[model samples]
Target chain A: MKQGAVDAVIRGLKAAGVSVVCYLPDSLFKELYPALDADPDIRTIPVTNEGEGAAICGGVFLSGKRAALVMENSGLRASIEPLARMGLGAGIPVIMLMSYRGDLGENNWWAIPHGITMEPLLNAMRIPYRVVRKEDEIETAIHDAYEWAYAAYYHVAIALSGEIVR
Target chain B: MNRFDCMEVLSAQLKDELVILSLGGSVDEWYNAAPHMRKASLFQQQLGCVTPQAFGLAVGLPHRRIVSLDTDGGMLFNLGILATLGNEQPENLFVVVWDNECYQSIGGPPTHTAAQRVDIAAIARGSGVKEAHVATDLATFEEHCRKGLAAREPYIVVAKVTSTVRRDIRRKHSDGREDKYIFVRHVEETENIVIMGPSEHN
Candidate 1:
């Protein structure tokens, strides 16, 4: 992730009233983690897995504060059940900021399944998401996700792909 | 000891302290034990989330006391949270697990702790929690909750309970959405903040 994009994520999350972040590191978004950890206003937590991160983010919402779960798209698969339980069953929203792992970028072979299953899984969960490719749209994508999620009492996803993560 | 006995002791110490109960038999018992207390319990909605969500609540409200009425089965399902909780070690968090040794609801099969296959308190300590203990009797359990609540430390107490059900607990369906709203509103009211429907929210 570019420094500009990293800064945009931090600012956007703060602007969207997300004061805490629970993340499981993935190589694609490695740089963003440190910046998030150093931010003074945001309470950053390093989770053992994406499932733990999703539930932690839900807890943050329950505590009268907004939070975001940052991770690779593969973590989405790990978090699906809790996400479903929270979003679909309880109307608790988890604003997810994930790195698009298996986009059109011809990279690692392990990345293929991530791209293939990402959208279909999102659709299956009825979670609204946008795959962001440009740097300029990163902030708005995050800001809008928090907005839409809180209003509808639903979860939203924003995957940074293309130039933003590459 | 039974779950009701353990919860009654803990409920006696609560005053404006927030609680998040694990899914299953523990929910109705806690509700029955302390009907007016501020609490949230996911009824058959999500499994293995009570502790993690309570951890989030503790982190979110660093100044307030947060309790988790977690279960042995739920704890086994997501043991990784122990590492995270120990690592963070939020001071306002207090965790109490009802270790009944089996899945009391789903035909009563033995869980990891049934024959001592897993020790949750030890795992929590190994994971990084500064204080963790096992209470087999009501007196030990009460002492632990009293001291833990007074100190407001990150403490985990695994209370051993029998598979016996409490006939007095009123069984009913608590929809996840309904619990969420009521719980959130209680937090807002106690904390003096507006939590519901906030875009540029605090």
Candidate 2:
């Protein structure tokens, strides 16, 4: 039996000592929401929007706890304000795990804009990111994002694309 | 009563509880009212984010009480946070929205709360915040603050106040970034946990 993507993501989050997660569900990661909610060690908060999730993550950071914001790549746009003010302005870091919605070979025509604007927007914010395509690489990407994010006191993102999100 | 009077009453009822002030006016008010309270920090003008940030603090540090002095304009920026708050319902969080009904810091443009009669308390209740209340007077606002802060349930108080804000008060901290450091340090000391990672300063 193959290891599930959700399990892999959970393992990575645990390894990074992430106790809290603020998420806004998207179709790409709908299954992950239930798993995150059920996990005893992880506190999952369902936010109304990605901006709320980002701010919540910032608040968690202020409490001396590790929190991650998990959302769709399109949500990166929604969260830019909080991310910019909190991370860029105030030096509070928020680690994000986003699902790559409009990646290559995507079937939905509407999702293309999400992909088209994703990398550029992230770059404009000066947020370092990695698009992880392999299931085996999920945990490393998550762990790496946290390590550097905390060290630099800056926002970092790992987008699950390729087969992982597909 | 005046916004400062409400803040003074709120300032009088403080101990180790964490305070998160909204962008401009509330931050200045909190600082002037309680200058040495490092546990209280100013989150820069990220309207629509302050209440959710307080919600995060409440949920994350369940042992500590989190109070957010959010503003009407700030709440209107992202009213969706009320629904999230009502849904998550962290018991330790107490929110007080100072409803001056306008953008007081930015030259007094009327917000929906002023023009369209946007009842934030009603909206909060509709969104599932059972403990939401509106305080048009200082006595009611103080009562809500005094009791709401002590309650073990999630609470919200929409304090309708005047648009008058004092500009003479100076910031205790140099900038939001400095205040952020102070806030993190206070939590690290009081909570006996290390929050800041290996940065250049560390």
Candidate 3:
């Protein structure tokens, strides 16, 4: 993943009107996390678990503020409950930006199964998502997502799949 | 009136029009002691999380009222939920954490929460929960709870109740599944949602 792409996401989130950001610790999202933390307009919430983060985002969005969740792909499974029950059920729009850890050209076998299942599971939930392989696409995708989210009060996601971090 | 009776009053007043997530400790004890909760089919979930669960429920069930029955001990575990709640301010949600001066779940051990005299309601205000207040006694609690429910913004009411609670009440659901499972099932069944967590849990 290009540094520019991560920066683009930060800019897009700010531009898209997201005021609260929730995330768990992840080495993969090193660059993006700090930038988000430093933003004065955004209140960054660090949670012990990804599930808690999801739940937090649910609350954040329900309060009528745009919110985002940053985490590794593995964290996805942990957040299943809040995502569905709160994110989708209440029409609270949450933008989930993930750093996909395993995929082609990746050596981490443990992360492979989850990475493989990621898209399919998201599809099963009927969540429309995008794979951000390049930096330029981040902004427009985010803008479109925000539009969809605010207009429909639904959740939107962007999966950073493949070997972008290394 | 007893703490349990206070909760019953809130439940009876709210009826099935709202959803609540009550935490452990005496709040759980009191909620369980109430005969109506056992008999009535309200959208109430008695699980591990009190405030956090309410946060999630409020997100999806936005149009309906959602409340969290929290305890000082449980709230201490993740007070950041308040910061998030304050920042998020879901108008349909209300947070009620009973600060009974002790960890009513364990052996009524004195909680450090009171040491700070945290004034949780003040904390809620500082954090940005639109409506926040602290109440002691049943009447005060009932009034605040009712006002919170009626408010147009997110509300937080911290009620100080007795630490002496029956220890024999069931602390958790009869089901053996951990808190993770309950949330995961909700995520799986819902659409347009993305979840993240539990790389591993003991």
Candidate 4:
């Protein structure tokens, strides 16, 4: 992740009233973690797994605040059950910022499945998301995701790709 | 001892503390014990989320006390949450696990706690939760609850309870969405923060 993209994402989160961020670090979002931790207004919780992050974000929402879960797309697979219980079972919204690991330019053989399953899984869970490839779209996509998630009481995902993740 | 007896003792001592209860017998028992407490949030779905959700609430609202009523089966499903809670170490959080040793809601199938001798409080302690203990009787359970409720450090009290369900005590099925709204409303009002907006009139 580029410094510019990190800054933009932070700005967007702050604008969306995201005071708590529950995340599991992935290679793709490594840069964003330090930036998130350094931000005085935001509290970053490094979770053991994505499912734990999802549940924590749900709790943050219940506490009358906004929270975001940041992780790799594969982490979404790990979080499916909790995500469903939160969004489908209980009308609780958890805004996610995920990295597109196995998209078009990927070379690692292990990552192909990540890209292959990300979109279909998101769709299956009925979570609306935006694949943000351009630098300019990063902030706006995150801002829009939080807005929609809170207003609709459902999840929204922002998948980073293209130059941003590279 | 029975879980409801434990719940009754805990409920009598609670004031302004937020409680999160896992699905199944605990929910019904809690509702029966403290129906008037609006600070309680009952889970109708998400079997393993009771503690993690409470952890999040504890983190978000550091000043308020968070009490989580979890079960042995729920704990077994998400044992990783114990590590997370231990690592985070939220001083205001207290977890009470009703170890009935079976999946009581799903027709009394034996859980790992029953067959394999899983010590949940020991697991919690090993996972980094400093104040963890197990109680077998009503007096010991009540004492632990009282200490946990008043303590500054986070506490995990696993009460060894029986598998018997009080058939006479029942609570209506709480809709998940309505439960979320009510819980959020309670948080907003107590914390003096705006969380939800009115639904648009179409």
DockQ winner among the candidates? 2
* Model 1: CA > 4 A from native: B38-44, B198-202
Residue-level lDDT of model 3, residues B139-202, one tens digit each, is 8878887888878888888877776666666654532123333433343344234433223333
Query: Over the full model, what C-alpha lDDT does candidate 3 score relative to the true structure?
Result: 0.65
How close is each model in CA RMSD to the real structure?
A: 2.1, 1.9, 10.0, 1.5
Interface RMSD for each of the candidates? 1.3, 1.1, 10.0, 1.3
lDDT of 1 at A6: 95
In model 2, residue pairs whose N, Cα or C atoms come closer than 3 Å (at least 3 residues apart or on different chains), thus clashing, are none
Question: How many clashing residue pairs appear in each of the predictions shown?
Answer: 0, 0, 13, 0
As for candidate 4, its interface RMSD to one decimal place is 1.3
Q: TM-score of B chain for each model?
A: 0.92, 0.93, 0.73, 0.94
Best by lDDT: 4
Cα-based lDDT at residue A40, candidate 3: 92
Error at A2, model 3, angstroms: 4.4
DockQ for all models: 0.77, 0.79, 0.13, 0.76
Better of 1 and 2 by DockQ: 2
Determine which window of 10 residues in candidate 1 chain B has minimal summed lDDT: B38-47
Residue runs of model 2 more than 4 Å from their true location after superposition: A1-3, B197-202
lDDT of 4 at B17: 89
Q: lDDT score, residue B125, model 4?
A: 93
How far in Å is the alpha carbon of B186 misplaced in model 3?
26
How would you encode candidate 3's per-residue C-alpha lDDT over A1-166 as one tens digit per residue? 4577677888989898887777886877888788888889877777667767876675555344567888987778877655675544444446788887775767777878778887887887677888777667778878888777665556778877554465
Q: Rank the candidates by lDDT, best first.
A: 4, 2, 1, 3
After superposing candidate 3, which stretches have Cα over 4 Å from the reference? B1-4, B8-50, B53-67, B70-202
